[model samples]
Target: MGVLLVGGLMACAPAVSGPSQAALAAPRVALEAGHPERLRLVVMGDQGTGTETQWQVARAMAAVCAAQGCDLGAALGDNFYPAGPREVTSPLFRERFEVPYGPLGIPFIMVPGNHDESWLWGGDGASPRGAEVQVAYSRVNPQWVMPARQYQASVSGLLDLFVVDTAPLAAYLPSVRPQERPGGPWDAAQRAWLAQAVNQSAARWRLVLGHHPLYSNGKHGDAGAYDHLPFTFQRGGAVQALYAVACGQADLLLSGHDHALQLFAPQPDCPGTWTAVSGAAGEVGGERRGRRPAAFEVYGQPGFLWLEITPQTLTLWAYVVGEGGAVTGTEIARLSKGS
Candidate 1:
């Protein structure tokens, strides 16, 4: 079946199966072709299930990027769902990552999510190579670009993105998932690296990327029952890291874990740091709710985020993908830093 994207782009990519009846039942939005911005990038997370919904979203992203000439695609963790792949040669890799996203063509800058680190816990009965296997896979696939668990990259004059390994660090903390015991010796080291990296970056925009959010409206939000009180109970890493980013003059933070589309207004305390949650890419975890903190929030709906940056302004678009794979978008917000 052909799904049309904005700009007359056809979305007839091969899927393991067609989108479910429920997805098709939802309201459909027809997206227009091509964005007006010069530089564009796509961001989304929690999309590694290899389901038809995931394929639909992938096809939408591929079409949008193709129509507008995108520079890169960012996967905000949860790259592989459940326990992650056992090895680079695992069939899960082909079905989940290679097949769905191979059509996009742009390099995917990714981070590891909690599900991606399930292999770290011996009791889970998952392979121990979850994290390393993905990094290894990146060596083979030119499109998958994860150099290290925690590293930073710059797009010359546009931005500098720092991807962090938050799972192991959260596991190291006392209040954060004490039962899981994700003990890795690198928690302190990653924290240190994040601090230094944010402070040292000289790019126009400094974006910190990770799977877990510092603040979210979905299940991980401060008010939610699941992963409750993350900011206070979890180690000082997330808060400290945000502070560092704000201190370094960074305005935007991108993350996924909450499984929703959320845009948080700047905190009264941290005036310049705006957080965007685009986890609604592949799957919806649960309800999204945050009245005071969230500038805009959408739960259960599945979509990805489009960010376009010119020399002076950055505009964000939230593209909603229907069950039939048609994409409709809205201009959610924009930011401008004085030149």
Candidate 2:
């Protein structure tokens, strides 16, 4: 990836192609000048391990939110370990989620990951009940939000978030256990919902959040060729085609499954959107496989992402946490039509 400067911050441009000169010359404008109030959000994923690292990341989040301000949180997925909770009342909910992130004092829009939908392990798909339990918990706790497997949420009138459940789509791929396949047509319905929801939404910014990534530089790789399985490559191609609606229309595609923090510049397929992977909330330790060129990529560290959005701009700060759960360095990116 080539180096690009944004607001005096050095960022790696996508390796596939360089950005336009106009984008590189775009000025770093102040977010508060004659613009709508900015919305602050914290994003993390694969964090339901109930481990010390998860607590550490949560503490960092609390401290950051305390110093700054967070209006909402986006929990990408893998909410539960091994398998999801046995039921909505399972103690894991408290020990893993409620207790660790309770101090954030904001609602977390959540989606389910492979582990959350699996029965024995992540590879073998389990009953949909695992994910349903999480959705049911939404009624019990206002902070835990998951109205359905796939839903749309409008946040503070600035963002329209379209959440997708990609576990079944991956599980439904070839060479997977038969029992893991979803009972009905899930992919079609989700694609339809996303295409319609994004087109109809009137919000200034649109984001699609999911458990799996459309593009990643970590081990799992992109939507196609996940885990580098060649047989599934074709199926993964279908997966990418399904997400074309959001890739072409939405402003950003955010996900977490690679257990690392990554930011990729727009790709040829997903030209209009940026790809962000923040899956290192609890687990950390992965090689930058370099499956794709990334604007920013980091591994073996536990951290999350912060975003400040206004009608005209969306600024991203990728925070890297050190051994003591303290922020070490920040990579900033200011994105707009010109940038």
Global Cα lDDT for candidate 2 = 0.72
Question: How many residue pairs of model 2 clash at the backbone?
Answer: 0
What tens digits encode model 2's per-residue C-alpha lDDT throughout 1-339? 344332222222221122232231111111111224477779999888888888889888888888777777889988988779868889999998888887676667788887888755653434566777897797677667676777766644567787887786666333243432333344555676678778887778888888888888788778767776655532355457557888768888889988999988889978878889999998787888865678888898999999988777898888777877778547567787542
Residue-level lDDT tens digits of model 1 in 89-160: 889878888788776655667777767767445212222246667877866665676656566655544666
Each candidate structure's TM-score, on Cα atoms with residue i matched to residue i, is: 0.78, 0.84
lDDT of every predicted structure (CA atoms) = 0.64, 0.72
Q: What lDDT score goes with residue 156 in model 2?
A: 41
